[model samples]
Target: MILLDAGTTYAKILNTETNEKTVKKVAELEKTFKADIGTGHNINRFAKQSVNEIIALSYAGKRLIKEKSFTLLDVGSRDAKYVIFENGNFIHSDWNTECGAFTGQAIEILGSYLNLNYNAIEPQKEFITATCGLLGMGHVFDMVASSVEPGIAAARLIKGVCMSMYRFARKPHKIYLTGGLVNNALFVKSMPVETICLDRFTLLEGVLEYAASKKDDINL
Candidate 1:
């Protein structure tokens, strides 16, 4: 089975066999297929196309995993999403569209300001008390402008992001963290639950898992 996680910046694909799983960037596959897929475009359209490719490759069958009881938190470039799943199907999800500070764009902006790559920042040592993304960004910028070390600043930003996510979670269940920011150790550590940071193939895995389970049903 093939899993596809399509994001605003990049897409990940996971090929899962009985014993092993292989992961790669969707862009690499696009290169092989000679397609134009990149960031800053229509993500939904790209996502559908990417899933279709994975489905065709699997041949075994393709399914989009839609768990009804699981809450999937996807922190993407432009927004943060809180998705609810129940009975192995998606119920509903919420997105923080008005606040861009908690999204990947803020992270990128901070990275640029500090002249540090995203990976260079260290894990957070303190917890953030900010309630909203915009307020959090203001606090972060003030802290950064005061000559705070980039690592700690990054950590604090990550902490704020996690805290924002925690607020939106209505029930206790396994929390899945996906998207670009999942690479931050501080953010993952601050999660209230035993968070699973599927940094590599989260979305793709979801797609493949969904496809496999719904093959017989064929309504997905």
Candidate 2:
């Protein structure tokens, strides 16, 4: 079985049989998948193709495992998400409504300007006081020009985001962090509990696992 987790910036494909995953630009997959090409925007186009692929695979007699007991946390360019799973199926999800300094886009943009890698940001030492994305960037720039190290600034930014997600999660369970931001070591380390960084393939693996597990019941 194959699982695909399509996000705003990239797509993750997992081959369950070999437990190997591949990451690629959503646009690249569109040609082979031949699904709705949507607008030129990769995020929208990729997301649409991902959904279509999942549905098509299911209809092709593939067994997909969809577990509901797990919680899936996807942090992306636009927003962050907290999803609950039950019996290999998605039960509910919550997302940040307004754009803020804690968003992935804000982090990446600021990180680039500061010449800081996302993984290099250390959260334990720095304090981030900004309430929104714009203010956050402004504050970061101010610090940067004043000779503050970019690593510290990145840490503060990551800390703020982790705090935001922590507030949204109520139950204590293992969290699976997905999306491009997961590559950051500082951000992953800052997680309150042990976080499972599945790089880009987590969603794909989840989808494939769910599909495979349900084969007997759904005739997939």
Candidate 3:
């Protein structure tokens, strides 16, 4: 079975039969390409079977996390969502589409605009009051205007974005972090709490889990 986790900016795909995993821009996927099971914003356009992104996240977290009490946070290109599990049961979950706008994308744009490499940037001690990424860019500009090193200013903005997601996840003591931002070294370093970065294909794993649950009936 082919599974997809198609987000606004990128798609993570997996072929269950071959264990091959790949990432592609959403625009680059051919109209003829389709997944047997999938989740995310563009999934509806390309998937024969669709699942709620949050439901996919929950399944992946439950299957991969052995902790009885933990928070699973998935930060993507545009937004962020989290699921809380306690005593091995789902307790609370939230998806913040509004406040999380342009999360990973903003950081990427900032890096590109400044010709900065996030891998070489270090997390900053001070951060701007970036309630959201777009708003954070304004703050970053203000700092740059004040003669703060562009690299330092960018790191601070990235830290603030990280904090925003950390707070959204209810300031968990430790987080099982997933999604695109997990690949950002500075973002990972900026996390205020212990962060366990999961595979970027976590949501795709959830798609597979959902498919497996119906395996007998679906004949996967």
Candidate 4:
């Protein structure tokens, strides 16, 4: 199946059969690749069959975890989401909109600022405390000015962001961590509660499930 996540910043395409994933800029995708199944900011514009992101994640998360009740914390580009799954049923969900503090994009920007790759981050302590992404960046700059090592500054900034996200979530029994940040070793290491780090394709998996459920109704 061809699944596309037309996210605000970067767009991703997943080919399930080949188990291959590709990432490209939204602008680049706009001029190319018609989506068979799509979810994200401009789904209505790009998708032949558009699916709601939350509904998709709900179905997708269930498909992965099966009849076990769990919570899903998805930290995406512009927003972060908290989804509750009660034995594979979609029960409750909430998201962050008023601030960028809960976003994984913040981590991306942090990596650029400190020149420390997220994937390369080793286990470290939570030092930075700024909740907002931009604010955390400001703090990073201040630390650099104070002659603190860039690596340490970046790790602390990431910790602050991850911990802030944890504070936003209502802790449940089981937790699955989804989004770009899951690829980061240190952030995953610092999570207070043990979480299953899912691939970035979590939402795409949901879209595919949504499409299958609607196969008879939708033309696509």
Predicted structure with the largest lDDT when compared to the true one: 3
Residues 1-220 of candidate 3: C-alpha lDDT, one tens digit per residue: 7889999899999988999999999999999998888899899999887989999999898888888888999999888999999999999999988664787888988989989999998889898767677888888889999999999999998888888888888899999999999999999999999999998999988777776787775544
lDDT of 3: 0.88
In candidate 3, stretches whose alpha carbon ends up further than 4 angstroms from where it belongs are 216-220
Model 2 TM-score?
0.67
Error of 4 at 144 (Å): 1.9
Question: What are the Cα lDDT values of the candidates?
Answer: 0.54, 0.58, 0.88, 0.76
Candidate 4, 1-220: lDDT as tens digits: 6778887777878887897899887778755567777887766666677787778778778777764688888877777777787765668898777466444676777677567866666655756777577787788889888998777787787777677677777765456988767777878876767778998888898887777888898676
RMSD of each: 6.5, 5.9, 1.4, 2.2
- Ranking the candidates on lDDT from highest down gives 3, 4, 2, 1
Give a tens-digit lDDT track for model 1, residues 56-128. 2122111223333566676666666666656754466666665443456666666666676555555565755
Of 3 and 4, the candidate ranking higher by TM-score: 3
Superposition-based RMSD of candidate 1 using all C-alpha atoms, in angstroms: 6.5
The count of backbone overlaps in candidate 1 is 22
Residue range with the least summed lDDT across 10 consecutive positions in model 1:
53-62
